[model samples]
Target: MADSLRRIDSGEASDDYLRGGGTGAVWRPPPAKRGALLQEALVRRPGSCIRRLAQGDRARQMQFSRFLHNGAVTVTEMAETAAARTAVVVAGRDVLAIQDSSELVFGGKEARARGFGPIGRGGNLGGLLLHSVLAVDAVTGALFGLVDVKVHNRRGGKVAARRARSTADKESQRWLDGMFSASRVLHEAARITVVADRESDIYEEFARRPANVHLLTRIAQDRRIEAAVDGSTMLFAFSDRLPEQARFVVTIPAAPGRRERAAELALRYSTVAVRKPKNGAAPDLPNSIVLTLVDVTETSVPEQGEPIHWRLITTHTVDSPAKARMMLDFYRRRWIIEDYFRTLKTAGFDIEAAEIQDPDAMVRLVAAVAVTGVTVLQLVRARDGTTDQLLRDAFDPADQPLLETISATLEGKTQRQKNPHPKGTLAYAAWVIARLGAWDGYYGKPGPKVMRIGLQEFHSIKYGFQLGLRDV
Candidate 1:
């Protein structure tokens, strides 16, 4: 199948090769066969269409199906495929690969399966954890692709759980696994920075990550360490170097959900290089340089006079007090991933609702959803390039009647009057695609929703922009 698609893409085979014929086989070429084939191939079982395309004299399609059905394509093969796709998308870009985990709830009281771990209760359903690595363009926020995904399972024995570890103690190990897998796809880039929350502060994570991959994570309160200068081990403490003039004020915007407003106080500067005690059992652990910024805001002063503080730590060099302040600005971008997850779950890909029974199948399905979301995000970023107008021109083309229909439907007085959300080129494009996918029913009649739209539609709209590049 890949060879035939390659031949077609290379113009080596005539359209006849794709036409219907004899031999009890029917080949119906869709209007957008290239896009369709590529999209389907992205998610289809390995070698499913290889023989049907007749690119290989040996290895028939049936044989390939048998291979996949027999589980001949190992998990390593799937991981490789994901790595390749990620490399293709992120090549030559400055990106921050963000790693996090979420839960997918599965209902019913069936026996827990291996590789399935209980996360938390969700209404009447039970949740299973899914750990994912998402590579995002640092400046543009475009999703490059997924670095890797693992289903967190607790049913597996302790050894198996250790093998598929999810605890902070194991994050660095997982980071190593993802880095190697991504390196296979990305080869060596100039730099690859990894950003995560406080849970990522495992000693091994900082010790083992490739030097080229800079690590930035929040610091947990329970983390114990010592100042590296004197080799003195003690509990981590807040920097006492806060400016004497620093004043804490209750600001509503800075501290949301505070009943009587919240204080936003900034300390002047402080740096602490983390060092573990040599006498400890884990003496191999190396010291990690961390610049700390403690922001104490009074969300609600308890009757006991206790104050709340948000502590942030970073590996970034802070030459001056001003430089340290920028660390907060940099950390704000981490919230972008939260927005992304919300958009992904609410827009169409309700990953938590997936019903795939097997762990492998669930992994594949979640990856597929992430792929689709990334493809759309690419379009959004491309069209909304600095000159926001580019998106309006691209989606509201005057020459294309189909696009015109989409515009007209969106511009209808009823839609304008009834819909409160402001519509723009990006929104219009999303709405059009969603509507075409029968996202919310074009005219109130039931139609395909964003989730129901197959990969073909996503490919057609995306490739239609000439943004897609063929893998050589």
Candidate 2:
């Protein structure tokens, strides 16, 4: 492992994507020296603190700390690198860019010291607000990676009313910003579909959507429709009146207070012209925009559970039952972003536990974790072989040989102990890493924590392997 650091320090292993120059206030990628350090820090244990990432080397720990606190290492540069990597995988493929926001609460005193803003409903909490977009293969549901990320805290004290504020001055603007960000990053993709939850159902989100990019979001408000079509009926009531087209069963994942249960959902679809509100923020948008609504309602509800219902609004063509199902599947991909937040928070990185009090350093840490969190998700997504991702998705081309050797050494003579997935696939690499993390392959699937540990071990071994080659 020491040998790898030496190589990086000498600029022998600097990332090609990070080599560039910048002018003005824009944060360009660091020079080869810092670029090498940045790459090493990112590939370290995902979600680990600086001390752990430094592996008890006191000098390395200080260097890691300096890297985070450095003024040149900005979130903008980190996001650029993430986008460049995502563009490679999504090229020529239809992709879904899932956008969502999450709050990281660090307490009232911590907030005041760290310069964080209020985050809860009552405005009593102090934390940072993170909105990000994760790209996925539309057809296969394979994880592509993060396309864009925005991290900012609200103003210390807010005194503006909803009607008084423009979309640029409001937090809700992140939804529109995410769309623009994804479009810029995914220009290489054959098709781009942006998916979000109800909070993203803004007039501008639908109006300002980039050409060739589709939008899908759950209905948030009981918005009014154009009166010419059906006597000024509202969206919800109009949806309820639509005839059911099909019924399907789905297993709903368990949440904080909600138990997992099988839901029988009746699907309905219709085209409606959504009328712009009298006080709509964006006056430049058309008075009405035609959109397809796919309504899903639970036919049978469990005794202790609320009935599942989702009125999905989309720009996708949903004239047929098959197309409606496809939209639902795309909307379902929104959960991937939610899972990513969990991985960054309590599940994998435990980012909230970091003791960095400086606001800038904390922001940089979040940016680094934002990229690392996706790596953990990639491993979890690949563990089941459902995602047809290649080893290159999560690892470098040079690392493939090391993974192959590790897989062979970990396998036993018994077929049950062998890696079942095909070689050069992310699933096969995941199996090898799981075994390295002490997982019994037959027990169950390897989760984010297992993948995190396995990744740490792999990096350590990879460095030692590089050292041996240099010695030879």
Candidate 3:
């Protein structure tokens, strides 16, 4: 075996990381130079990861599949790369590990996609499930990287039919598992705030917080609340009695199924002592836990539009209006992971469409592509450039020249064409990318479609530039 293929510790760094480092973790060293080649092949052709392999000669394509199914390149090691990238990004920053689960449905009807558990209380398709813990800067609201990912097949046959299973044995336990894994990995961050959707409103999870770890989650259960000034109350009842703290505006980004809208929302929050489950399902739960509840209700919107109503629970001290708004923003950042999942599916990487049939190989394939998906989404969201992050943070040195060329071509003539955002800012790279994606370069701001298209085009340009350089 080559020196590069040495089986170092699980948490080692990759060799080709000088390019501002994507999610390139040194999952155990490969048996040969295969590790480096695998990363490069994925980086070069991510949108159609499996297709890229097929496009090659027959012998080589088999090599690709063989590599994916290799004994050494397990999903656990691939996740190590995501963890490594995340640790670097959130080293000293106050960040949120936005946690969520997404399922990939491979075949249409009952194909029984290998190695996948039952999803959605028993649904149509079969495929693997992933729960991701992605780290994002809380202050700038920028996505740093994925801190951790847990991939498993659901077991919902007669196994799920067994009614005696504890909640710990259920799938929802993935939420708690994701939180603990993320917290343990990102404990060094200045602040590790776990943000989740309403599904994570687990009382036991709230009670299990580690030091310096906080949670800002939407309240799923309208559980019981301790007494107010006069009498006992339930969750929403406690929320209804609170005085309005303030009102604010938030930008709701567009998704595949939803349109973008700005919402003027009303805010009301109060502290509550949450009583334990009276039924006593959870024996380990505390008798009562005190937490701040923040309600952000839509003040006004067109009747045809969906109204915004968010009942959030947080460990943060929400005494002042400013603090309350801060927590809401943290909760909203949860969308970052949602966008990553979008990239993993049809919106971008399209990993589910891979032609591989082997279950283990598909899992390994999805793991690598998951990191690539994050890289693409990161470029799309790295607009603020508040951190003045270098273009090198995302673009390679060789690729920068091509990016500058496109940037110059896009910024034709007038001041509008000239992106005023300084170099090294994400906005600067984003402007160039949006233009490459075929934006008019005059639109106010590019939407996800434009960013997604532009990223694909930019990857092509990078590939071409590399080929040209190699030909020299």
Candidate 4:
């Protein structure tokens, strides 16, 4: 067993390592390179290992490299691809999915070349937009992975002279194309449900999505739908069947490029049925479910607000009032994606400031970064009690010394000082892990305001210690 461990740790393992050499024989090697062996073991462990493993996927790397060199692919396509892959690997089929887009503004100069629209009044301080998909474990509220990312154009009003006659740039089409492609990928994985805001209710988006995949999307005030019982045409509106305590509020993040605030609402039971348009082809939609529309407004700081009334359309079935309420609860999970985007840009990956010139390279890099974030979260969640036996089981026995070093460092820190924020308490270990994963975000004095201790950081610290163990 020791010999096989040595061979694997040294990158010298061969097919013969698995072959039986002798009966009741236990191959052992002299104790040496213990630190190096431990470091290798730490790298091999799952849950924060994606960042390193990403360097080894030749096919994915090659595809990204080609796209980067060509400058033809858009960030949205890459994000969509990453989201689709994540959905398959992490969320599978039984999860309720939330998808949304947020704007980030790079500088006007960066936007000019990237074809991003100009910053509207009060938008992010010159940043690009990012749209992302978040999957929450239905029972645990744990973040699974990012399904997609869309970087909006910063120069929306500018038009190049050569393409002045065109309606839109080819880059814009990539968002739609990527969405279509991601939908296919989701369909291939499992029977899953999707929830989105009204922006996703466009004809192409709904029409192109796979039939089996369920969607719950907010409706525009101008959207037309018919009453299932009355057969009368009208704009979709929330039914008056909500609980008296329903409320709504908006949220605005202090991050750059997000000048606008988002609305969050809490509503009660309402009926929704498809109303076919008078002149257009009827949408191929399944049975509709009535739901209470809750619009949580965007705000920089949490505050109180009035509940705004709205309506939504969904493909899910809400046969009972309780089921209808549950659907609304599911929709609230959409905020998880927003939190994820903030974490990626401000805390974990910092995708916006990345200098990779090739769009493909940017995509590959973002994918790797996003996956690394998820991996860190997974590792932090896996730790049990003070020992973290799960990590020990996955790591090679030779890597113990490095792990002990990390444990000692953490042991010295006060529990109150680990995660000062109330929301980040569950993710205190994430901060340490991020350090192990090679995250450099918290290097400066006192860390940034947006920098909360998180799982990614924990993964980094833990992995770094493991690497040290392997080298010892």
CA error at residue 146 for candidate 4, angstroms: 3.2
Summarize candidate 3's per-residue lDDT along 1-472 as a digit string, tens digits: 1333332223234443211224322222232444455555555455545556445657556656666777666666656655766676567889898999898877744447464555554466678888888878888767767777777766555564423555587777888877887787787788889999988998888888777789889998888877845556799877876788898788877655678778898999888888776662477778888999999999877334578888999888888899999988888888878878887787776777777777677777777677656666766776545644556555554455676777887787888778778865566887887787677866566645567678767767776776898999
Model 4 over residues 215-296: C-alpha lDDT tens digits? 6677664544446556654443334433544444544333343444565545454444443333333345333323333322
* Tens digits of lDDT, candidate 2, 18-116: 321110011122444544444455555655577776667787677767767767566776677677678777889999989999998878765766687
Q: Each prediction's Cα lDDT score?
A: 0.45, 0.78, 0.71, 0.43
lDDT of 1 by residue, 1-472 (tens): 2333223333343332221100111122343334223224322211113342223535343332332333222333333344445665455666676776666665544415433454555323344555556666665555555666655543433443443444344534565566555545554444566777766665556666565666666667445545556554443443543453244453432222334345455544455656543332244566554544434334455433346554665556655645544554445456545544543465445566554456554444444344434434433333323312222322223314444444455454564323222344343344454454544433432112242352235435544543444532
- C-alpha RMSD between model 3 and the true structure: 4.1
Using TM-score as the yardstick, the better of models 1 and 4 is 1
Pairs that collide in candidate 1 are 1-50, 115-153, 249-263, 250-262, 251-262, 438-448
Better of 2 and 3 by TM-score: 2
- Worst window of 10 by summed lDDT in candidate 4: 18-27
True-vs-predicted CA distance for residue 130, candidate 1, Å:
1.7
- Score residue 98 of candidate 3 by CA lDDT: 92
Backbone clash count, each prediction separately: 6, 1, 2, 84
Strongest candidate by TM-score:
2
